[model samples]
Target: MQKLTINLALITPLIFVVMYIIPLGLRDLWSPDEIRYAEIAREMVSSGNWTVPTFNGLRYFEKPVMGHWMNAVSQLLFGENNFSVRAASVFSSAGSALCLWLLVERFITRQMAWISTSIFISLFMVAAIGTYSVLDSMFSLWLTAAFSAFFFAFTADNSAGRYKNYGLAGLFCGLAFLTKGFLALLLPVIVVFPFLLWQKQFTSILRWGWWVIAIALLVCLPWGVAIHLAEPDFWFYFFWVEHIQRFAATNAQHSEPFWYYFAYLPLAILPWLFVAPTAIRHLGKHLNLPLIRYALLWAVIPILFFSLARGKIVTYILPSMVPLAILLAVGLSSAYQKQTRGFKWGSVVNAIVMALIASAFLILYYLGYLPLEQGEHYRPWLAFTAFSFWALFACLAIRTTTLEAKICCYSMMPVGLFLFFWASIPNLSINSKMPAAFIEELKPYVTEKTILLADHPSTMSALNWYLQRNDVYLLNSKGELEYGLSYPDAADRFITQQQLAEFIKTKQNNSTLLIFMRGSALPETQLPGISKRFQRGRFSAYYFAKDTSHD
Candidate 1:
């Protein structure tokens, strides 16, 4: 036990450093949710509205307060930047590693525990999203924490008193709920209990379990009730509509085929790809190894659950990666112990081949040899190259009859470190350039008290966030012109180009600037009160002058 604790202490620092020091290149900055969520959190802090999250100064309650709160706190402490926002994910990822270590120590051998935790931290998806500033990273971390606490509670010597660990488990679940929502509570029961029951340890259920559950509810209900009371629709939209109905029904916009997760499986697992079969085989052989069985259940059940789920985002199966790493680690590490020739050569060759393929592709991508549609797809290309190289490096350790072979087989640490620094961190650096340009262009007009308005508002969320203001006016097509200018909401205050023309005919204010979509169908001959037009990326700004008004 002491040795296991020491292993955890050593592994904890290493994982934390890996998560903390990794580069956050501009990989997916403008990708719908990542930057948007950060920007919303920034706006919430700037606007002083902790009750409801707003995007572009509108009631945007798609997700819960956990992520937004993290963002707000991050911005408060470090200023509103990618590094600050992403720190939440980094801490959560480290917590996940620590949780895995604790879980393995309790259920498996000390060596297996280390191996499992190491592989988990090194997983492509976990490494990719974990190091980034996104909700999934934190969500997965909390999910793991909850599950890990539950596992220890469930499998611990009941005579030793289980309530403490069980309560901790519930607390972690509550934390998860805060991070993402109810998926936090649903995940452990659905995923873990089936495996425990399959083992026919029905009597294995302990007394203090209810307390953990009660704590989870205790932590979750207050915020949920507050939101429900404050915005009754908020609870309905978030809990039932988003969680249950979205999963139960189709068409919440996040839809993928049942096989979608299957396609992502290899990529998600990455350097462990070659050892997947062996891991499955080892899982079957060691059914009595409660940790291995639980890990296997953990790995496989989420895939099945998500594959059947209507919402099939890649991160949906994130919690499963923890178990996958454990299963793979046990498989490869145990195979090394078995001294099998086929296992040794096959794994090494596979790694080398995968790495060579990745290196070639990366070289091509860097040289512009591979033509992609846009910059966003760079994730897949980068992931492939990084995973391949790591797999190759790991293969080098797999020699005929040497402990070094085993070490080589699991060389995900360096690979994860390199990708975290070279790939994931730097990804944000690349994406921040365009937004930086927009911010620079808009800076001259923006003042401490400027009432900035954009037609889509989303076009300016990043801008508003960067400028650290919540006063951006979103002029989308919502009905408000009917009030005859007595009063208007933010949505109605936006005068259409047609409205702008009429207003020019009425008042002749030529200096008014109208920001419109580049392809919007504004008739040129409606009113000849156009002073100038400027185009920037996907948006166009028209400076309408009253002098040229000649309908």
Candidate 2:
């Protein structure tokens, strides 16, 4: 146990720092999510209106204020860069892992705590989203905290401990509520109430649930009332459009087939694929254990809940990964104790799978199917090299006698795989996904008085962020901006590609008109009076000089 403790203590921090933290600032902020979150946070800081979140100078209430608040605070501390943008998410994941560690140590075993925390830190989705600028990681942290606190509360021997833990649970619930929305509060109720009923302690909720609600309400009340007072229609849109509509409406955003997460979850949690088979087998025997039951409830119930929701995204199941790490760690620990061949066989399977995938990519690249542009000459080689190393490490895991060495080697394999994959992406793909270079090229043209326009909101967030100007008009004016643009005050900011010519004619004489059309090229005839155009990779920027020659 001492060796295991020291080993995990070293391994987990190494994984968090190298695998998660270092890589955060290494990549450009990907548009739509990363840039959107970054911009919202940037705007929050710039506007000094932490109560409300506005994207591109318009009211955006798709989510509550806390997510932006996190990023906003990070930007203030870390100074408005990629690290600042994604710092909140990394910290959230760390906090969540710490919470899982405490819960497992208290209920399960100290060894299990180390194992679980390691697994949770390096879990695929957790590492991926936790290092990106997104609300899910932060929201997942609060959710994990609430679940852990609730568990602690329920198991407490005395009323004081119980209520105290319950209050902490409620505090997290309120924070979660602010981070996302009503789902935070609702998800806990569904997950916990059922667990309590199973224990025939459902009556306890009636007695102690008030503390949860009162504390949560107290935490949320200030912001809740603040937003309502400021926006007046803040709850109306957030609740009806975001919450209810997203959950049930036919035209919900990102609606997928019911089995979407079920289909992708196995792939998302790929590193632990080796242990999954054994975990399933071990689950029945451990089902009687209270911690196991709680973990199961915590992990599975949310997946089921999110799956049922019409508007589902893979990140919604992040909270599920916490308990899942606990479950996976315990399962592997049991297999080690029993001296089973499960670990060896699982490693063998992983080795074969990784080798096969690496071989397939090499073969494809050899056949000239995977072409690389001039600058990315080494991309394919780097990626395949990473895959080869992973395959080699999987084989090494199989050879190791101790489970600690095996799990460490196995879990850390994805670090090389993912970092290499991220690093080796073709420059063309990079330029398209991350348009910072293109935006920077157009810097001289963009001024305080320049009339900036983007074809879509997907491209607008980066433009608004990189340029540090949000008053830019939208040509498509759709998606998240759809809600913001619907307001009458946003009318002047809305313009379509078809109407660009007429709109440009009105302002072209007085203000320099710069339009960024992303993904596709628009016809010259449509762009009307353009004096200069800058084309970079997949993006095109049209510049109309002040007082254009064309009528």
Candidate 3:
């Protein structure tokens, strides 16, 4: 059994990598988030200045430098492709799973550790974030590691080891801060402080030595100080505008109601959602366990904390998954031991939930509500998921009398989910807008000397990354680039409509200007000699003719 557990431990991560990591470069980098971060890292590499992160050659201080740094390093090694861009996030997420396993193993049996790690990786949000190019996974990794380290510190037998553990925790927290920002530091404190208080470890909380702070400051402050020295305005923008104003105002465009997470958390843990109630109930019975209280606090406090903030994004509550995974493992482990009737019922209910979700998509597809391109292609996968769920339910209902058999049956669901994502998501093309064919068509019209113009460049961030140029001009719009374009060197990059008209009027000899604008935003009075080169979806591309005598 021990050997089997060890084999499972080794095999699970390999499966995760094949499912999550291997497909990093398979899809085109999507817009606004994936492409934006990729372009920033590309700029960091090109500029040779890692301290100040930039998007499209303008200083972008919206996020800290560590994510860019990691991405930059990945790009350096793998070259700037989808895989390189997302490699950091993938590895970070894997690291997070490993940390969870180690942390759980410290408190529970190896079997439970395996269960926790499996649950963590199998989470829909966790797996999705692992594959995407984003900072949240990396931030979650460091935050989880920090919390794990702190847990060790609090439970340490020797004073010397405790201090060392605390320092390691601080270092991970600092790295988390570098990855995202203050929230990295804030999340750990919110989780750990209350947990310590609940455990009546007041002395331990108070004795969280000064060296921990010093170590964290040492890791995080150098970058802050360096960026401030390089760009004096960075601190104000990062701390005030990006953090404070973003939270305080709904104008940041990510505003959701206070109950947003309440609605989304269950979805984030799909297939596993039905298992959560059993976990919470089991946790309630074991409140005296330090780890149980810690896990509960860790999971619940972040939700409450982010709920208070007006700007709510689903990813903001990602760290909660770690504790929730622990709780699930605990509950499931207990259920496994007893072969409880509740576990059987939970499996049946979970299958029903999965079937209902899949059936809804199938119904939508059949009803013509979902797009044919996505729905028709994805329908079979949805059917497969629903079928697998019911199959597992039948197996559990009829044949699975033992705990191991039930677990094996339960594992089939995530395997089906993995296959569905692997086979179906790329075909849907939901994330990608600038198709390769479109890019290839546009490539022939562009040259080094040609200027690319977009009315709203933010809408086409993928173009910036794919074109591999920073000289793309924005016409009569700043959008998200406003922060970066506000820098003195970038001021000339923003052009007014009048200036655009002037440029069209006085075309330079042998110099071409290509403009990409929304089809709706196209000028009512078209320029006389400008020819519409290509029309794809919502975007229209045009080239200005040198001689305007003939319409």
Candidate 4:
């Protein structure tokens, strides 16, 4: 075990690089979420307006301002690159891991704490979201910190410590509120109150919970009041559209069946899921204990609550993974000490799955079924190499004598795979899902004076973020920008294809106009004087320089 500890201490830095840091810049910012967040942050930095969040210079009330501020600060520190864009999320994920480590250490053993931290970081969903330029990881971080603080306070040995930790929890709750809005307050209330009630310490809420509320409100007051004063309707739109309608309406955004997370969670947990059956069985023996009970309540309740909501996304359940990591770590540790076959079976399952994947890649490549350009011949071998390493490591894990060594090997399995994972993404998916690559090539020709246009707000956002310009016009459809586009001031830029023709006629002959359209976008019959055209995968870009043809 000590040897495993020393190895982990040495390997942790490598894991950080392989799993977390490397992914930040491996691919261009993915559409809507990544580019959307990055643009808002860029605008926040450029416009010097931190109070209101804007996307392409339109009022976007979908979320609160704290996340943009974090991203903005990251951009400031690191300049406008992929690392800066995703730095906030990466740091937030690390923060959550640290908070989990602290709780596991106090409630369980230091060894278990280390194991839990390792497991949490290695989990596929956690690592994936951590490096993505989105607000979910930041939101999950605050939720984890707040919940951990509450747990510490509830279990604290004395009064002063309890209040201090409670205050800390409230502070995080407020920051979480800032990150994603009332959700920060709602989720904790749903979990903590029930937990305190279950502890038969419900009266403690009457005595001390008021202080928590006061502290949270105080922390949120500056931003909350500022936003309300800045845009009086923000609270109304955000509360009704983003919260109420999104959660309860029949036509809520991203609505899915209750089993949505139930299905994706296994994928989220990945190799750990191979062992979860045994781990859960082992942990079941300790469910009645206070620490385990508290963690369980924290993990399970939010999933049920979110399931109750009409709308759902995989990331919505991310905070639930925190206590889950603790529970799984404890359970896995128990099973390891008991010398059960569950661990060996887990390694065997991981090996089998990886081997099958590697074999499938080879079969598909040999059969010529893979969608690859001639130049992408290397991606197949790269993927095979990655999956083969995964299978090899899993076999090593099973053959390894020590529990710590086995778990360490299991944890490192994804690192080799992730190294090649980005390189292995097929160009087909890249063309549709990731537009930044296509947009980056066109960025050199664009300038502040250039009129950029796209059929989709998602594509427009990519142009906006990549070109570092907010004036990218949405051609024909407002999409998510519907509410923002309805305002009279935005009428000039958000126009139809016919209007685009008339609009371009008024521009100077030297002026540049670029249109980016996806595979499904209607063919252009109205666009005139196309000088140059570029087609990449399913996307087509048409360039116009007014009565001049460079073709």
Residue 207, model 4: Cα distance from true site in angstroms: 1.5
lDDT of 1 by residue, 1-551 (tens): 11122344365356546445556543335534556777877777877878777766556656788888887887798776667767777777777887888777766667666676667776778877776667888788887887777677776676455777778888888988888787787778777678768778655544565787799889888887887786677766677766776787856447788899999988888656666676566555766777777777777877888788787688888888887777777776666667655465657766766667667766766776654435445654665656665565555546324543343345443454354325432323433323545455656654564444455544455556667665554444432112212233444445665575565455443334434332243465776555666555444555454344454
Tens digits of per-residue lDDT, candidate 2, 183-210, equal 8999999989888888889988899999
| C-alpha TM-scores of all predictions | 0.80, 0.96, 0.91, 0.96
Going through the candidates in the order shown, the clash numbers are 21, 0, 0, 0
Model 3, C-alpha of 369: deviation from truth (Å): 4.5
Candidate 2 ranges beyond 4 A from true positions: 1-6, 548-551
Error of 1 at 174 (Å): 1.6
lDDT of 2: 0.85
Q: What is the lDDT of residue 310 in candidate 2?
A: 94
Q: Model 4 lDDT vs. the true structure?
A: 0.85
- State the lDDT at 138 in candidate 2: 92
Order the candidates by TM-score, highest first — what do you get? 2, 4, 3, 1
Candidate 1 segments whose C-alpha is farther than 4 A from its true place: 1-20, 25-28, 203-209, 342-395, 399-434, 448-458, 475-551
Candidate 2 residue 279 Cα shift, in angstroms, is 1.7
What TM-score should be assigned to candidate 4? 0.96
Q: Mark the regions of model 3 whose C-alpha exceeds 4 Å error after superposition.
A: 1-7, 250-252, 356-369, 373-399, 402-412, 421-436, 507-510, 545-551
RMSD each, Å:
6.0, 2.1, 3.3, 2.3
- Prediction 1 TM-score vs. true: 0.80
